[model samples]
Target: MSTPAAPALDSLDLALLQALADHPRVGDLELSRLLSVARATVQGRLRRLGEAGVIRGWSPELSAAAAGFDVAAFVSLEIAQGALDTVRDELLAIPGVVEAFVTTGTSDVLCRIAAASHAGLQGVLLDLNRSTSVVRSTSVMVLSTLIEPRLLPLLATTAAGREARAPAYR
Candidate 1:
């Protein structure tokens, strides 16, 4: 299915979003100064934008590698026809399966798994392959994560716009 079109944003909104992207924790006063808008206007815009669902709440990014989860691997799965549901459920139940996506490629499911060591990852891979519903799985261990950023460029723009609309409190 096609993605829904995003609402049009004015230049001011775009500027606000960009500013927020650069610094999510930036207060309304600072944002107001940066965007050259009144603090009250910034607060109002931010509230409106959030209510519209354009700006979701912020979250912190954690590093799995630094937190003792050194092993990272992508498991590509091919499940038996009519067994997709069962396979998906079983995979989700497995601990350390961080993310899973049902896709239209050679693999029916793509999963990102993290473990403390290579041995731990091996165990998970073996368990997946042994499942009757899973016809086959290809595991690719991550040697290194080259590009994983906390924020995307579009999000910065969106957040700035939303913050710009936050209500100004005297």
Candidate 2:
């Protein structure tokens, strides 16, 4: 069973998250040393955070280009009414369609997909269209990424909020 969700993260919780973000390769022992806390403390904190779903397992970030799937696009899909589930299942069967979401717009579903080339993308689109559930689709290819994914700054801000409420003695 999943553990109960955690409430607002405390200062220490934020500190550990920040430390891990800065030094992803560091072990718990090194983390405790850097933070000047007991090793078991670090271990326990990580365990609790993980069990509470605050800490998701770390997975290496791989570049789509490095994997030879260079072309990336956000494809908005207009799904046939009453076929959302069928279209979603169809999308899942296609490896090129990486992420999909139900959206509020002209389209019913939005997808982020990668292909080796424009021709490959066309094949992906064609494959998607094979499912009659997918009525139509519009794709916007990514020109470039100005900012990579990051959440540390926002986490820091959350920690600051907790700090503001901390007891003076703490």
Candidate 3:
């Protein structure tokens, strides 16, 4: 069953979310202690947050280097008009193609792909070119990644803004 939808997040909700993200392995009991809330409150918020799609249940993180697919690259492709879905389907069929996006600018779509080596990447690129709708592609190899995915800082800023707006209660 789904929890009733929340129009927007309150500061307390953000606090609970931040606390959970900071300690992913912690249970509701521990969360309550960490956030200074009742255990039941933590449980309720988690349930609501999950149902609201605020928390997509945890997924295991994978490293391409550890998996032996070290080569990483982003490819921009120009596709025939009205054929994005078809080309996307073809790109998804390639095992090396990890993710894709439709974006603005010179190219119609962009994709992130990985390979075991330079030769493997060449094979993947050739496969990408075989799509009937894809007319051209430009690939850029990733030298290194400096920043990884993150969200805590944004949550903190939003939560602080909400707190500042709250009036002193009677």
lDDT per residue as tens, model 2, 1-170: 76575557767777898899889889999999889999999999999888877778888767898899999989999988899889878998998998999999799999998999999999998888788888888989988888987876777787788878788994
How do the predictions measure up, each by TM-score? 0.70, 0.87, 0.85
**Candidate 2 off by > 4 Å:** 1-6
Most accurate candidate by lDDT: 2
lDDT (C-alpha) at residue 19 in model 2: 93
Q: What is the C-alpha lDDT profile of model 1 across 13-107, one tens digit per residue?
A: 66777788788889999999999999998998888767666777777656787899899999999999999889878887888788889889898
lDDT of each: 0.82, 0.87, 0.86
For candidate 1, the per-residue lDDT at 56 reads 73
Local error of candidate 2 at residue 100 (angstroms) = 1.3
Candidate 2, residue 26: the lDDT equals 92
lDDT score for candidate 1 against the true structure: 0.82
Give me the displacement of residue 102 in model 3, in angstroms: 1.1
lDDT-superior candidate, 1 or 3:
3
